[model samples]
Structures are given as structure tokens and as C-alpha cells.
Target: MNMSEWLVRTARRVPDAPALLSGENVAASYSEFAANAARIGGLLRTRHKVEPGDRVAIFMKNSTAYLELLYGVWFAGAVAVPINAKLHPREAAFIVEDSGSKVLFVSGAEELHSLLASTCTVHDIEAEPTFAAEGAAIAAPEPRAPDDLAWLFYTSGTTGKPKGVMLTNANLHAMTYAYFVDVDDVLAEDAAVYAAPLSHGAGLYNFMHVLRGSRHVVPLSGGFDAVELSALVPRLGNVTMFAAPTMISRWLTTARETGYSGEGLRTIVYGGGPMYQADIEAAVAHFGPRFVQIYGQGECPMTITSLSRSDIIDRAHPRWRERLASVGPAQSCVSVRVVDADGAEQPPSEIGEIVVSGAPVMKGYWNNPDATAQSIKDGWLWTGDIGTLDEDGYLTLRDRSKDVIISGGTNIYPREVEEALLMHPAVSEVSVIGRPNAQWGEEVVAVIVASTDRPPNPEELDAHCRSLIAGFKRPRAYFFETALPKNNYGKVLKTELRKNVSGL
Candidate 1:
């Protein structure tokens, strides 16, 4: 079944419900939203000659029209390839050419049409969507099989160029079901805010809200703005938004400085990067029980594991803090394991490569059979993350396999060191990386972002590390900075940082 069927079904049940919004104002009702998608589908099939099984790319920022184009692609049984609007034109063009997309719908980036060197026809979303609203309508969505491709997601390439992960209709169905079972539940009165990029995990969350006939809101700022959100929430009550850890920290800071209480915001599902304990602890203390955590990569598409709202706020349990530090148990649709290199499962409390097998795993990488075979062994997809599983089934991430630093034949995880350093009063943010040493092979080093009120003393930080973690795990040196560099997704660019290590 095509995923667009959910939109059609909801429109039939609740034609007058709010379906799309721009800030606090409603842009389209459920009936109008579904009709717009059908007309856009007609434009794809009749005007652009897009057919079933073809790929259509969307390089757009968050907008009310973005959802229309996405469902429009699905209505025609074509695959949707959404690229981050922040990506360079060359990088976005590479994805368009590699996917062999039939058409590219661009928003916000006007120069894309002129600069894009691909054969795919480029359409300005601001203009084409208007034509779609008036064009002939498709009678119904094109039929799609369970295993047919639905979404093509590209991985963040820290090491090399990115590869496209192929997600099928069945895989998306499983992920949506898991969201209701393991993540937060959506209501018709709730509105999902698009603060993060619509090209990644936040975009994948649209299905549940659409299925329940809820409002899909794109902020007036087009992206995360603390002032915009704090004011918008009151107009549209019972709001939920997917956010990264850095966004949560920023939200907390805004709340503290302005005394803006979290009154209308319902929940913020945080993931896509490590949420250090100190950051989450402060967020929970300020916002009460409004945060949930999920752990997954592009391969699994946000269905691997989840730390629920109840578990996050359960301070009554003796091991609550330990559980809080974990990514929580395996979600309903998947089996997670920590395994050795030889594909054997590691015992409890031993760190190893984390692997998963389930309904939500992708079909494979697009047009790369060899890479697909290398990643998925037998029946399991070997996630490149390094982590351990405890006796009660909770999984704790150590670091990425490549990020693990070996010093004098002993492995040192950066999270352990970084977690310790963050507990200091003056330590605002920190990232840990290994520096090459002839004597020790690699020595642990810390990059600190100190608070404006009190800059940390290196000697005091060393004592703080001594009190929390092992001596050898402590940083051998420190570099103070105003901020660490991050990728578009808010993950610390350790690879970029490693390039500057010798000078630092």
C-alpha cells in the first residue's frame, strides 16, 4: 500500500480539521491538503512524465508546501529524496544526479536551478505548488507494493561521500507503528512543529500526525527560533516537535534567560546526537517530564530504541540514573545486540559493535550491492556504533567504532571522559578526541567551551576528572574555545577537529 493512503483516509474522516499551518494561522484543511497532493501528483504524471518507481528530489527548507510535495510524490508511487537545504549546491546536485531523479523541487535556494548540472528538471516550489493547486487531479494514488522503495535517505559522510539508504513502504509502516507503541502518541488536537530539517528524522515523523488528522506547522522563521517557538506555542496548544540535543540545550538557555515557562509545549523527542547526562538533567529539571530520547541511524530510520517519558522522570527507582544514562531497551519491532567482530554476541556489560535485525531496517543502499552486503551480514544490519547491553536489556553507547581511541594497547571511550568533564561548574561544553603520541600511541585531549561567568582552570578540571573517572581516562591536555565546530546536524565534527590537533 502507498503511504499516501493515510492522508486520503484522514481527509475522509475529518475534512474540516486543520491539516497544515504557517506559524499560528491555518493554511489548509484536511480536504484541501489531500486535494493539493492529488493535483501535484497529476502534475508529476501528466506534465513531468514521472512514473511509478521513479525518484523525485526535494531540496527545501521547512515550509507548509514541503509536506504537499512529499505526499504528492507518494501519490504518484515515486520515491522521495529530500536533501538538506543547508547543503552546498554541488553536494545537492550530486544526490540528484546519483538518484537519477525525474524532477527536483527546490525551495529557498533560487540559484539551484541555474547551478544544478543534473539532467533532472528543476522546479521552484514557490511557483510550481501554485500550478499544482489549480492543475487536474489524480483520481487516486498509484498502487505500491510493500517492498517497493518509498524514501531514499543519504547518510552523513564524515569519512567519505554519502551513500543513499533505501527505505521501502513496509519499512516505513513498521517505523510508524513503533512510534505509537514506543515513542509518544499523537492526538488530533496536537501540532507537530518543523524546527529541524524536513529532510531527516524530523520529516519521517510526519506520518503519525497526518494519520491522526493533526496540524503540521512550519515556523515563520523556517527553522528553530526560541522566540518564535515560545510565542507560537500558546496560539497552537498541545505541540510536539523533534529536536536534537543542541537544540534542547539552546531552548533551555532561552527559557532560563527570559523566564519563558514551557507552558504550551507538550513534548520534544531528542536524538540524532549524543544527549550528555548533564544537559538532559538540566532540561528535565526545568521542563519537567516533557522530553523523550530515541536512538537510531539512517539505516534504521528512528526505530531502534527509545527512552520513554516515564523512565526519564522515574527518580523513585534505585537505578533510575543508570537507566537514564542508557538509550533504553530495544523498541517493539527490533532486536538489538552487542556483538564481537566474529558475529558472536558479547556478554552483558561488555562493549562491542551494536547490531540490529527487524522489520524497520532498510532494504539496502541504493545502486551499491557490494556496500549493502558489507553492512548487512546474514540477516542483521551491523550498526557501526560501539555500545554495551546490560542484564536488564538496556543499551549504553560508548562511542563510534572509529571514535574509540587506543592508548598503550588499552581502549579509551571519549564519552566517559567528556561525561566527567561536563560535571564541572565552569565547563559549559566539551568534546574529547585522541591526539597522536609517539610514546602512548594516542593521548586523550579535551576541547573545552567554558561558561562566560567562570572560565575553567585546567588544574581544577583535572581534579574534577580525577574525582569522577579513572586517572588514565583523564585528559592529558586541554584547549579552551568559544565553541566547537559542528556539522549541520549538530554533531561535533571530530574529524574536522582532528585535522587541527597538531596546531592546538
Candidate 2:
């Protein structure tokens, strides 16, 4: 099935139902949104000469127009390349050039104007989305094979240069299925807010909600703000939004201060980064049963293990805390495994790289055969995440494959130590990294952001770790910083952190 068909089919079913919103106001109905998409698609085909399989990029922030452009691109039988609005022009230009996109839909971002003059044609989104009614009318969404490219997701380039991950129509179909089966029981009345970047996981979920004829809401702030989100809870009832773990933590703090119980929130599907056990438990205590945790990568999008709300509140089980600490069992469609260096499966309680094989997996990296070969082998995506699966099939992630610390022949996962440090009352956010040491080979180091007015000193933090984790895993040195460097996705940049402590 063509992904764009979801919008067209649902519009036919519920023509007058609200389909898109900007803040508290209704932006478009199902019928109107479909008509606009058809008009834009018609323009792309007849006027712009966009052919099937061509890449059409959208370089705009989260708004009503962005969503329409995404659907219109697919409707026109072209692949959508959604660029991060936060990226520099040079970075965005690289993706436009690499994808060979002939046209770009952009807002009035001064940085992106240079790219319009260089490689691709540009369309300003601030103007009314009106197209001449003259093209061969689009009767229906153009047909394409299941494996044809639907989205070209460029990684955040934390480890290296960003590579375009080719997500297909079939991959998105599997993702939508996993959403209904494992994520939540979404309803037609449920609404999804786009506070997170639409270019990333937040935008990918547009189809899943659109499939149910739910509302796609873009916050008025055009970005995430805890204060604004709390106000919108009751205004937009039964709301669900995908967020990073850091955003969840910040929102919880704001909720407490404002006495907002998240009265209308249905679920907050958090995944982009690790949600520390201490932080999650606190969030659940405050927000009630409204959290679902997922673990996925760019290669697979958001179809991975999921920890449901029932599992979060299920305290009667003997291993409830352990299960809560895990990213949960694999989803219905994907097969997950933990394998050693030679692709051999690891036994329970042993750490190995997490690999996935399923329909949701991407085709390959675009125009990069070497990266494609390294990431996908035998139809399995090597996720570069180190984790273990328990007897109950629960998956516990230790750290990224590149983030492990080897100290005196004993390997230590940073997440283990970071979790311990987070238990401290004074610690707000913490990132653990390994620094080269001649004596122990690589020493564990903790870089912290203090939560309390009176920050805990190194001596106090050292004793705190000794009481919780193994002494060898305790930080050899502690550095107090106002904040840790992070990417747009809220993951702590351990690579930059490592560079900061390189001379140590």
C-alpha cells in the first residue's frame, strides 16, 4: 500500500472530521487536507516535472504546511527528504545535494536561501498553498512497490558523517502495525502533538495517527516548552506525543511546579534516548499510567522493543523493577538478538551488540555502499547498541557499543554507573565516559549537571557510588559542569565529552 493512501482513504471515510491542527485551532479537515495534498501533488507532477522515485526535500520547521508537504511528496510518487530545521545551511545543503533533490520546500530561514541559489529550486511555505487547477488531476495516489523509498532519514552524525537511511513503504507499514499492536490503543479521537522535531521520529508517526483519522497538532511555539505543553494538556484532550527522555524529565519538573497532572494526556511514547530508571520511576509516580518507552534507531525508525504503560505500573511482579529497567521485549513484527563479535548469539545476562531483523528494517544507506554493508548484514541491522536479553525476554541496554568503558580488564557500562549517580539527590543530568589512563587502560569519568542549589562535591559523590555500584565501576574523576553537550535529539554527546577530558 502506498503510505499517502492513508490520508486519501481516511478522508473518504471521514470527510468532515478534523485532520490537522495548529496549536488550539483547527487547521484543516480530512477532506480539505486531502484536497490540498492532491493539488500540491498535481503541481509537482505536471508543473515541477517531479517523476516517481525522485527526492523532494522539505526544509521547514514543524507546522501545518510541513505535514501537507510530506503527504504531497508521497502523493506525487516521490520520496520525501525532511531536513532538520535546526541544521546549518551547509549541513542541509549537503543532504540536498547528496539526495539529488531538484526542488525544496522551505520557510524564510536566511541560512537556507544560499542553497536555493546553488543546487535546487525553492518554494516559500509562508505563502498560501494554492496551485493552479490545471494539471492532469490526481485521481488517486500514485502506485509504487512496497520496497520503494518513502523517507530518506539522515542520522544525527554523532559517530560520523550522517548517512541517509532509506525507509520504504513496507517498512512504514510494519511500523504502523507495531504502533497499534504494541505502542498503544490509539483512537480516532486521540490527538498527536509535534513538539519534537518533525524531521525525525516525531514526523515519521504522522502516518500512524493519520491512519486512524486522528488529529495532527503543531504547538504554537513551534518547539517544545514545558510551560506551553502543560497548558495544552486539557485543551487538546487524549493527547499523545513522542518525546526524548530529557524532555519528559523537564516536563515532569514543570508539571510539579504548576500542579498540572497531565489530566488529558493519553501516552508519552519516549524513545530517542535512555530514560534512566530513577527518572522514569519518578515520572510515573507524578504522571500516572501515561508513559510508553520504545527503543529504536534511524535504520529501523521506531519499531523496536516497547515498554507498555501496564508494565510501568505493574509493581506486583517479583522482577517489576528489573523489567522497568529494560527497554521491554521485542515488538510483534521484529526479531531481536544480542550477538558477540562473530555474530554468535549471546546467552542470557551476557552483553552483546543488539541486532534486529524484520520488515521494519531499512533497505540500506543511500549512495554509501560501505556503510550499508557495515550496518546491514544477512538482513539484520547491526544497531551498534550493547545490551542483554533476560530469561523473560526483557532487553536491558548497558550502553552504545562505542560508549563502553574498559578499565583494568573489566568492562564497565556507563549507563550502569550513570543510573547509580542519578540516584543522588543533587545530580540533575549525568553522562559517563571513558578516559585513557596508562595505569588502568581506560578510566571511568563522570560529568555531571547538578540539580540542587548546593551541588554535591566529588568526595560526596564518590561515597554515593561506593554504596550503590561496584568500586571498580566508580568514577576515577568527577567534573562538575553547568550542562552536558547534547545533540538536537537530547542524547549526550559523549564524543565531545571524551574530547573535553582527552588530556586527563
Candidate 3:
């Protein structure tokens, strides 16, 4: 059955059950959510003329309307493209244009509307009613074929342009099924709080919590608020939440300061990047051993390698704890291997590229055959992440092959900024690396070796970058040195650069 129909079934099963709660407003009852979705779907077709298979982009922060729009798009047999609201106007425009999205929905954000207006038809959600007049029950749009594209998720490209990862209906279903295997008991009575951006895989996958008949709650400001989370955690009983390492760190700090306790937290899943040992320990101490760690990519949504609560409690030895440093074992229906350049699997403890083969892997990159060929070879996805599989089959990530910088759960490619920086006449060499930040899991730091005797200040360099790239990609810190470290082959050793910046 099509995933959209699942909601209709759910509404029938539990009509009065709360499906979504956005701050003070609670969209209580699945019937309410289904009717709202159907109305929005009717509006898109009758008022906006949105056609089946057409791309509809949602450029908004996390909210109830955002969730409804996703279902509305699916109900209309259109593909939903959720863009990062934190992205710059140009960056946002690039995605809208790249996907050839026919209609853009903005959350009353003038900046987003103006940006997308140049490319596609823009619809403002705040100006429009949540639903239109009740129309005849439009037969749920035809069930999408397994291979039909459901979502177009853009990931950082090594070549300086973002590549849209085309996820099929089957891909999402496989992920949902895999998630259920890991957490078997997620039910309609539970509630999930969403703070992560729905644009990323982590945030979007958490929506499965809602699909299971749980209520979804968003923060008041539509972004991460530690102070707000501390209060909200108790308010929403038996709620599960997903957070990045940085977010968990902040919540832990806030909890300690105010003697906060997770009275209602059942599961706290953390992903997007590594959680430091200290942070993990602190989290376990405060929240008890109720944390779950997931590791995967957008291409293979939720093909999780999870560190369960049991594993966290049994911190056996320093070596065993080091295994905790790894991304954990593959989920059911997934096979993982560490392979060398020749695609030959490496033995345990040897670092190589992590390759995965499974039903959860994406069909291909949208409209990009060359990229698809490069990433997927013979049904296996070359993750482009350097990692090692342990004797027990757990995978430990070393580094990303592409210059993709993940900072605060957002992916940023260095080439995108480097190309922009090259425009400056005074710049000679530039390398952007993710430096450990207490708040942001990683913060962008650019190391530049200037050609001109008078070096540009960090603000000047930042301003130049800001003009070309998204705000998130702009460097948070700058360092000027004589030259970048390179090997005999003249290849810049990013390892050395990272070490220097890390002060190792």
C-alpha cells in the first residue's frame, strides 16, 4: 500500500487521537490531520493546479503545517522537496531550480519567497488557509511504483554543486521497516518532539514516529532551544526525541544547571555525527541508559548501525568503549563492508571506504547519471566515508572521502566555498575543515595562505564567502599561515591540516 494511505487508515483506526501538536496549538486527532491534508491536497490541485509527479518544495521551519504539506504533496501524487530554511537565498534557489520544482511553499518567509520566486511559482503558507472547502473525496493519488521518486534530498557535492539524492517510495518504506525492527514498540499513544531540520535525513526519518500514530511537537521558535526543551520534555509525557551530539550536549548542560530530569523521555536517538565519549557518559548519567546512537547517510536513510541502551550500560573495557566510538553493527536487511580502492573487502581493523548494499539504498542521484554511476556500483553504495569494520562487524568511521563538512547536523562542502574564495585576488590557498565546537558538533574553520603580503582579515574573507555561499558554509574561524602542508606528490595532506587545527 502507498505510504499516504497509511495515514488514512490510521485516522480510521484512531480518529480522535492527536497526530500533531505545534507549541500551544494541538492538532488533536488523526481525522483532523487527514481532513487538513485532503483539503490542502484539493487546494493544490484545484487552486494551484499542482499535477501528479510535479515537484513541490517546502521551504519552512518545523511546524504542523510543514508536516501536513508533506502528506499533502504525497496525497497529490507530487514529490516533496524540503529545503533547509537556514540556507542562503541563492542556495535555496539552486535547489528549487535543480529539482525543477513547479511550486514552492514558503512559511511566510519573505527571503525564501523572493529567492524561489525567480525560479518557480511560490505559495505562502501563512497567507493561505490550512485547508480549502471540503471537496469530493479525491481518490488517493495512485500508489507510486517502487522505483518512483518520492523525495529529492540534496547532499553536499565534492564537485562544488549539490547532488540531489533521489529516494523512492520503496526506499522510505524499507527505512521505516528497519526502524521498527530496532524499536518494536513505538505506538499511537506516544509523542515525538522534532527540533532537527526536516530537510536532513535525521529529522525526516523521525517522522516515522508520527507514522506509527504518535503525536509530533515542534518548538515555539521553530529551532533548537535547550531552555524550551527542558520544559517541553516533562510537558509531553512518554515522548521520544532525536538530537545531534551538539544538541544533546546543550541539553545535558542545561539539565545539570537546573537539575532537569527526563521524566517522560523514553528514547533519545542521536546521530548526524559522532558523540564524544565524555558527552555520551554525561548523557547516560543524566538521562539514564535510554540513548540510541544511529549512523547512516541520506542515500541510505536509516540503514542504522545502532548502539543500543544495553551496549551503553555495559561499557566493558577501554577497548570495548572504543568500539562504542564506532558506528555499531548494520541493521537487519543491510550488509556493510570496508573496501579498498579496487572494491575488494578489507579485513577487520583495516580502514577502507564503507560500502553498503541493501534495499534501503537510494535508487540514484536525481537527473545525474554520472554521479549515480560513481556512487552506486553493482547494487552497492560506495558511501565515500573511510571506515573500518571490526572483528565483530561493527563499523568505525574515520573520515569522509569528499570534503563534506558536517557542522551542527548540516552538511557543507569545502569546494563550494573554495570556488567562491578563489574569486578574491588576494587569496592563494584555502582549505576548510570542521573543528570541534562545544555547541555545534563541528564548526567550519578556513585556513588560508595569502598570495598578497597584506592578508585579508577574517571578517573580510567571511564577507567575501558570504556573498557566494550559504550562511552555514561560511567559515566560523580563519587562520593565516605561510603555506599548507603537502606531501611529496604535492597533494595537500588534509590530515595534517586537521591535526594542526586540532592542536594535536
Candidate No. with top TM-score: 3
After superposing candidate 1, which stretches have Cα over 4 Å from the reference? 108-110, 127-129, 402-504
Our model 1 lands, by Cα RMSD against the true structure, at: 11.1
Preferred candidate (lDDT higher): 1 or 2: 1
lDDT measured at residue 228 in model 1 versus the true structure, 0 to 100: 82
Report the lDDT tens digits of candidate 3 across residue range 1-504. Answer: 455777888888888888878764686578887877777777778766778778898888788788878887888878889888887778888899989998888876677565554447787767865444543345565467877777888876889888889988888888888887764358766777888887775456644765777887877877788888788878888777778888889888988998887777888888887688888887888889778888888899867477766776676655677666877888886888899999999999999999999988988998999999999999899998998888888788888888677787777888888888878888999887878777887878888999899999988988888877777889888888999999999988888888988752
Q: Candidate 3: what lDDT? A: 0.80
Candidate 1 residue-wise lDDT, 1-504, digit = tens: 999999999999999999999998899999999999998899899888999999999998889989999999999999999987766565677788889999999965665666667678888866755768665888889999999999999764333355899999999999999999999999999999999888988899999999999999999999988878888887788999998776777778888988877888899998876676877898999988999999988899898999999999898988888889999999999999999999999999998999999999999999989889988998899988999998999999987765766554344668767877888878899998998764455689999899866787889998888765557778999998889999899999998777878556
Cα misplacement distance, residue 8 of candidate 3 (Å): 0.7
223 Cα displacement, candidate 3 (Å): 2.1
Descending-TM-score candidate ranking:
3, 1, 2
Q: Is candidate 1 or candidate 3 better by TM-score?
A: 3
Candidate 1, residue 73: the lDDT equals: 96
Clashing pairs in 2: none
RMSD list, candidates in order: 11.1, 11.0, 2.1
**Model 2 lDDT at residue 324:** 94
> What order do you get sorting by lDDT, best first?
1, 2, 3
**C-alpha lDDT of residue 61 in model 1:** 86
